[model samples]
Target chain A: MTTPLMIEARGVEKWYPNGFQALRGADLSVHQGEVVVIMGPSGSGKSTFIRTFNGLEDFQKGSIVVDGITLSDDVRQIDAIRREVGMVFQQFNLFPHLTVLENVALAPVLVRRRPKAEVQQQALELLDRVGIQHQAHKYPGQLSGGQQQRVAIARSLCMEPRIMLFDEPTSALDPEMVQEVLAVMQELARDGMTMVVVSHEVRFARQVASRVALMADGQVVEVAPPEQFFTAPGHERSRQFLSQIG
Target chain B: MSASPNLSHPQRTASPPRLHRLRRELFASPLDGLITIALVASLAAAATGFLHWATTQARWAVIQANSNLFAIGRYPIEQQWRLWLLVTLLAAATGLSWGLLRAWPRADRRGSAWPPNDTIAAALLTAISFYVPLALHAQAGIQMRWWAITALLLLVRAAAGRWGPLVPRQLRPLLALLWPVLYLIGMVLISGGLGLMPVPPAEWGGLLLTLVEASFAILLCFPLGVLLALGRRSALPLLRWGSVVYIEFIRGAPLITLLFLGQNILGFLLPGGLAPDRVWRAAWVLTFFAAAYVAEAVRSGLAALPPGQLEAARSLGLNLPQSLMHVVLPQALRVALPATVGQFITLLQDTTLLSLIGLLDLLGVARTVMANPAFLGRNAEVYLVLAILFWCCCAALGLGSRALEHRLNPNTVALNTSAHKA
Candidate 1:
């Protein structure tokens, strides 16, 4: 059975003013409930491509349709796209001044103008879902790397986003802590949440991903099912990346 | 001590005795000891001579006699209660506002800072603060009034500490309305026409005029500075250029030149009998000058912020205004605290320049007191008193800003790591 497309991007191109090309004709697509993991060497532009989906990074040339909101120069459209999309950063970019519950509840209450009590209740439930309900009152600094990343995931889930983007969320975690973040993501995928994750976690990609896409030198080099991609990646760059990371 | 755990932290130890450490650090070598002893002897000799002169020789009676003039200038003595009332209101306000922020970071050197909760300590500070005026034999009214303001400040602080942060979102409009409430109060206090005798702006002088000018300038200048900073960072060319031009133009001119223009030239610009008072004129000049420097300081703070703050706020679906209010400015203001506080202190001192235009602020009153034949030949006493007043006010502002900085951001606030993937 074919699933409906949740995201479709075509010929995405971006360049810095200083003349460094960060993305060159990168294309990405995700179907509803698909867990697509993009892996690449550093500077391969996988993170930049993911950021473009929500209009955080402007593209010089591209068409991205996420949840039917096209990325464009229009402010209202971009804001709509951002609301429908939730992003988790590698740094776990939680607001330091606010408590974990506030971090989760802030975007919905402030952006969506939802009822405070309702948003807070939902946030508490999200925290529990992420396995950090006990840390609802604690600030981000008080949490370990794994717990903080989990809180970030819950914060995104609080928005009830149609598409979730993870920009190397576990890249900043301790080796021992990486498993906990991946476990949460695995649970999220099991719930059929459409997610695009840019991470170097090979085991997570192999186990949880619907497809593993390899990017090299600012372009998508190959896209294949996880089992096939892990065993037989098409591109020379993908083989090199796999060997180097191993 | 016998079976300590393998902890990561260093072991604590009792510090060396002060005398032993001092001798080792300062008197280790014979030449070092000889030089240290000589330096100490010279400092003690100078301090003793200064104390002797201060205690007996200086005629502090000049300041004593003109204490009322120093406190409220030429305003009627009976009506001085209005100024005293203003002080009480402002002190209470300071306490309430101070209570809104959370406690200061634990890393502060003085331990727990002077928050509103520390009312007894505030009362003690108030009592101690009055000693300068009391030691010089100021009127009991002025001294008592100072203590009253300080005590009230502490009381309001405690009250605010209890319930200010607890003010629910529905009552936020009440808090928002406070700015207008304060404006109305200030206007009534200064102009005094609501069933009270009107004190002309010309009669406003001494600490009254200094505090009024600096406070209004600080209050008005901060919003203006924030606007200019936002405008300078705005994407629109018109707003950015307008802010840039205004900031550059005001910063180019000396504050004295701006004051001169406010006093001498602004009157010509206004229609006959419609000109604002010199006090208002000086206020405008000070506000404009301060806003420019404050804008620069705030811009530096904005620059210091990592780009991720904006990105994060934007990604969270916050528009520009919401992004700025909820995320960017909160952090930027903490970064801008010291520089903005520095500008405020400078503006306080620069209020002295208002005296050049015949506005009788603290310095102006001191000058007038010196000019009087009765107080002639005692310039030292008047100037010294004025210096002390200015120094105390500036110090208070610096301390307040430092406490606010520690409370708002602390060292843990800035989590903007340059490395995204690491």
Candidate 2:
């Protein structure tokens, strides 16, 4: 079996308006159904790099392709790329104004213009799958952190995305809530969804990730399977990051 | 369940007698207590004097004689049905639409904390200024119009209860999407149209004129405000700068100055030989003024949102328009309600200034009411009635905003109910 590339981001460079270089020649490639964990200290451009995949963040110079389409300045192409990519934010930004079912159903009904009844039916099912069907009628504000994050995941999944990007999804969770979110991610990985996750959960990476890509100062410092990357790092930067976390 | 952030509020408890609590609160120290007693005595004396004068000396003849002018001000009596019908339709549509949308929105029901003390005091003072003389039943025609309004409100309540639940949740956004169209139809109905006689806006007067001007400006300016807010935050410098200039310029100038321009100067801008009607001019100015304010309110609401919301919407494949209409606007409006309501109430009061421009607004017509030979020297009574009218309208706005806020804040309602039960 041959692996197909799902994302190819090369020579990515980004600078803030104030001349702060957040990304300098960052590069990474993700294959279909592969779980890539990007582990980095804070401010290493982990979030920025993932954001560029869905056009949430723009790079000054880069050729980033996702799901066979290359990123461009064209609105249509950006929209096209977004349809195939689902992103879960650290803040679990489930729309507070909408109930869990509505939040999950919003994209499909509004963007896809699918019939509301069908999407909402599927939403409740998705909620059931995430073990939060009981909370489906409730608003995001009424839910606990773990439940909100789960609902956020269900909301993203309702769009039927081909690829998922998790920007430190569990970072904002309380200690007890972290595993509940990770368990959902693990189940998604087992279902063979192509995923790029920027997280510091070393144990999660070792348990489920196909590859571990360590980033520093907006560039990929090392990439290897979790076992080799964690136990036998080839780069000093990778070793230093691992040691700091350890 | 009591997750209220207000840790300062004591638990709801059975307190001591009201007089005892009042004494403790107002007169904690001996000197303070003495002063409080003296003030209470003087206030009671003044109240007794006021009650005597109000019950015996004050003549409500001015109110009784000019009730028609105060309510509609010579709106061709036959054509008055148009206003009544418009009122019913607008109320029904708003009630139905809002009820449908109430299925979502976790709004704060703990009451919208009014922003400043001055506004409350001012509103209360104006309300108090007129209610004493205004309560007397003056005319059957005015009472019937009011009855029709109450009937319309009850109809809305019944309709929303029966049909609102039947509207599919997915179709609710479609209702929102259709607002501009519904609003246009409602405007044409009131402003005259298709088969109806074209009642020149010039003929709209008194409290009817005031309410129409303020309500239309509010309804129309909201969409404009949303657009302006988006433009203010747009990536294009042209749009962003244009919005900034428009908002700042309109906000920087006083509302009356803008009204003056709308009344006199706007006619010059229109094509020669066909000056725009007075009502349209006033409305245009009021809409612009209110839009600028609504834009700023919406901007703050937009700003209060975390960047994650937009990002989340976009990442789900929802395009700019879809994201804005569904995700962004709903949340923004939730935060912006109080500010929007404040602008609306202020615009309502400012409409009285149209009287200064020779329009027969409530205040303007009240002056006409006083000029009548029988009502001469009854200036205090007429003005007091006018104040009561304006105050009632403003109070309705406050109550509506609170209801909308409560409907939106389901979590707060949940907490409130559960806490009470506990």
Candidate 3:
């Protein structure tokens, strides 16, 4: 992987319309093909932090440069960044009206203006890779939570994105279904896709992530390689978060 | 047979026959027995009465062409066929198409909870009972166009089932756009423009003209309403305020007054010699008034969409127009379809108000029938027919919305049914 840094964020701050500061001076950087896991307690801005990478969440004062394009009020550039960075929601917002195959193929056909046959073929292949090819014709509502999450992953991947962000993709899954979704993510990570995952799945982070960053109080308290971050942490907040979630 | 599978097990006890179960259910309580008995007796009596009217006691209604005046005004007798055929075809085709789309399945037989079967049966019986009066009092002619339109509706329904296979998805927008375009062409040609086979605006009366005017109003109102909705939600203050004032003012007053204003007030706005035909003026006024109400309905749909949908589209690299067109409008229209149909029914009924401005719509023509010396007291009969026509149409539209809502809510049904069973 010879590509340079895919994302860089500095001094990112967001104050919601209701005066809640979701992200306060959050800073992060992601190099090409790097897997960064963001772990934190609930409402600690970890999900918001990852969402900013794809412009799903906007910040009040920050500079986010993704894939060499700057993020601002200019609609054009933000769209460009979003095309390169795909964010999967915790809710797995697949269109309920469409089949799993159509859901994956929709953005490719509509937004990317790809040929129908080519997109459909690629979507089928992605579904196969996610181990849900047989369920392609069925709707999301007809599938289990884990199966829907896998379809969501394949949908994001259909855009042929350079970076993927997962915001607790397994949080909504049944206990028995969690491993099925995590297995798909594990395969993607092994294939060298750059990923920023915000989850409490400590075992997934320990096995796959090159580096783990602990976020607390709308800020990244510490970032370290998996071996040290799990074994020893510098910040008291990181220690407390790990102790609670481990 | 194979050791009797434990007689104590509930499954081994033969299930009660369905008829016996029904008997128990219907006769288990005194209230149910009373209701069932009353219902059966009433139905029996009604059926006997209807049979007598249709078969034994009634004369066939036939319009007498020899003595009856053709077209009611200066219309050529040859051209009268076109209008009469157009009318019967429109009515019967509408009724038949409505029945095809929404007729319930055979097994349900729950006696239509919404429009009770009794209301339908009573209406049919009454129509049959009035055969003698109708047969003696009316006149008609041959109907080539009537058969043609009936055939066309059959073709449309037969083809609609194969719509997915026959129609390309991309062509759907054009298919939707067709009705309004054709309506515009019809209005222009019938209302006399382009110097090609012009039908004079004053001569436009009867059911054909009523349909033409009402459909034209609907066609014009939809786009105008959509534009108004967009304007009301626009960022610019001038456009927003203008839309609000337009919507509120038109909705505040009765449509009859608007027609009056169009007839009387607009003469002041235009130069004396440049004023359009009064009929055209009334058409525009009706279209504008309807557009306001339709705009509010569409706005309600727009407001119901979740903000996440817009954000999701924005994040997907869709610009404002793309987002609105692909995401926002599709969802909004799905929600707004029933309301749009409701607005159309209102517009259809409102066409009668044009009679106040001297246009001879169906209601206006019915009133003319009442003025005839022989038919002086037949006002009840004419008005009854008119009421039935309007009621049938409005009821069909309301039922269509309910069917569409249910079709869109299948998942909710499964969830609800499971919850109920639990």
In lDDT terms, which candidate is top?
A: 1
Ranking under TM-score, best-scoring first? 1, 2, 3
Question: TM-score for all predictions?
Answer: 0.87, 0.85, 0.78
At residue B168, what lDDT does model 2 achieve?
65
lDDT of 2 by residue, B146-219 (tens): 55554555455445545665766666667665567766776676668798878777777788788778878888
State candidate 3's DockQ: 0.30
What does candidate 2's lDDT look like per residue over A1-246, in tens digits?
278999999999999889999999999999989999999989999999999998988888979998999898998999999988889999998888888888999999877889999999999999998889998777788898999999999999999999999999998999999999999999999999999999989999999999999899989989999989989999999999989988
> In model 2, where do residues sit more than 4 Å from their true spots?
B1-32, B77-199, B268-275, B372-374, B419-422
Cα lDDT listed for each candidate? 0.83, 0.82, 0.73
lDDT of 1 at B53: 75
In model 1, residue pairs whose N, Cα or C atoms come closer than 3 Å (at least 3 residues apart or on different chains), thus clashing, are none
Candidate 1 lDDT tens digits, A67-109:
9878889999999999889899998878766678888988899
Q: Which residue pairs overlap in candidate 3's backbone?
A: none
Task: Give candidate 3 regions above 4 Å deviation.
Answer: A1-3, B1-28, B31-78, B81-185, B192-196, B230-245, B264-275, B396-422
- Top candidate, metric DockQ: 2
Per residue, candidate 3 scores C-alpha lDDT tens digits across B63-92 of 122112212433444445445444444444
Q: Rank the candidates by DockQ, best first.
A: 2, 1, 3
Return the lDDT, model 3, position B70. 15
